[model samples]
Target chain A: DVKVTQSSRYLVKRTGEKVFLECVQDMDHENMFWYRQDPGLGLRLIYFSYDVKMKEKGDIPEGYSVSREKKERFSLILESASTNQTSMYLCASSYRREDYYGYTFGSGTRLTVV
Target chain B: AQSVTQPDIHITVSEGASLELRCNYSYGATPYLFWYVQSPGQGLQLLLKYFSGDTLVQGIKGFEAEFKRSQSSFNLRKPSVHWSDAAEYFCAVGSSASKIIFGSGTRLSIRP
Candidate 1:
């Protein structure tokens, strides 16, 4: 089975502080993604990486950035965390863009900014 | 760009009863559609996906969904509901780009 591991399951940060959420997938998937899940909003993509050192912004990438130094690892960085940024963050990986290979997501990290 | 919409925000059903969840999409051509289930505080799990071929697609946990091109609807169905099935379900549409758009999601609750 493919396992996606998240660095922290829960986190707390003060407003204006920097935050980092990490994800690692055992599978050799090429595509990696970072998303934030909010109630009544579903899952919104923040950033995605197609290969090592390649990153792209998604629907909601205003206050967020991502790093993919390695193919198996993807990290989401909140430059300046705010109360509104407190939400559940998810990481996903896929084999390709058009292929039927489904997304394997991490357990997710629930961040609370005070 | 492809987008998805799940009309039902919350649904309640009794155990052993049939279940249906509605999903709609907006796309110019046939878009790849998927259904995912998420337990509280967990990641989304793939339930099923429809890329082409047969309109009706079978999925895990005895669940299925039919793709209606005319109406642009892909509704999920199950013969019998289980208490363990109570969770948030999301419908997504994948485009040619490397991104997939997800719906607002529907919260399902099973009554014993």
Candidate 2:
């Protein structure tokens, strides 16, 4: 079975602190994505990378950034964590331009900024 | 822009009862549709997907979804429900081959 592993399932950070959430996929997929899910709002995309060192901002990329240094690893970064940045973060991966095939998702990181 | 709507916020059914979850999408052309299930504290799992071909698509775990072009709907159904079937279901639409839009999700509850 394909696996997408997230580095942390729960995290608490102080305001203004830099935070990182890591994701790794074993499927050798070329598309990686970061999304923040909230009650009533569902999941909103933050950022996505289609290839190594390539990134694109999604609808809600204001407070987040992403890094795809290697093919398997994609990282989401919070420049300075704030209370509003706290949410369940999900990472997903898929084949290049193959959204129809769907994405394999990680267990998700629930981040809380105090 | 592509969007998905899951009108039912929550639904309850008795075990062994029939079940249906409604999903609607808005797009100019036929879009990629998907249904995913997420158990409490677990990651999302793909239940099924519809790309093309037959409007009726069967999926894992005895779940099926029928695509209605006229209605712009892709509704999931199962002949019988199980206690273990309680989970949150999300309907998603993909306008392009790169990005997907997800609905708010419907939480399913099963009773004995």
Candidate 3:
């Protein structure tokens, strides 16, 4: 079975601290994405990577940055964690535009900024 | 830019009742649409997708969605609701390279 695993299922960080949430997929998909899910706002995209070392900002990328150092690994970074940053973060991966396979998501990481 | 709207924030239904979840989208041309379900503490799962073909698309977990070009809608439906079907549903419209805009989502409640 295809699997997408996040580095931490639950994480707590202090305000103004640097935080990183990691994701790795076993499907060899070319596209990976990071989204923050809130109850009313749904899932807002933070960043996405189409290739190693390349990235693009999404709708809500202002408070986040991402890294794609390897094909299977994608990371979300918060330069300075704030209380408002507490939310459920999800990672997803899929093939290039040519394929029909939909995105596969990781279990998600609930980050709490204290 | 493509976008989706799920008007209903939550829907409550009986365990054996029929169910329909509404979804609307806005796009310049013919768009690829998708429906996904997320269970408690689980990742999102694709329930169905509509690209082209018959307007009605069938999917896993006894789910079906109808595409209406005139209305720009893709509404998901089920003959009967199951307790396990209680979850959050999201509708999205896909752009090139799999870029998509998703709706806020609708949370379903199945009352036993």
- Steric clash pairs (candidate 1): none
Pairs of residues at least 3 apart in sequence or in different chains that clash in candidate 2: none
Q: How much of the true A–B contact set does each candidate keep?
A: 0.63, 0.60, 0.47
- Please provide TM-scores, in order, for all candidate models, with all chains considered together: 0.98, 0.98, 0.97
Give the per-residue lDDT digits (tens) of candidate 2, residues A10-90.
999999999999999998899999989888888899999899999999999997888999999999999999999989999
- Indicate the TM-score of model 3: 0.97
Q: In candidate 2, how many Å is residue B39 off? A: 0.6
i-RMSD values for every candidate model: 1.7, 1.6, 1.5
lDDT agreement with native, every candidate = 0.92, 0.92, 0.91
Q: Which candidate do you rate higher for lDDT, 2 or 3?
A: 2
TM-score of 2: 0.98
DockQ of each: 0.67, 0.68, 0.63
TM-score result, candidate 1:
0.98
Query: Which stretches of model 2 miss by more than 4 angstroms?
Result: none
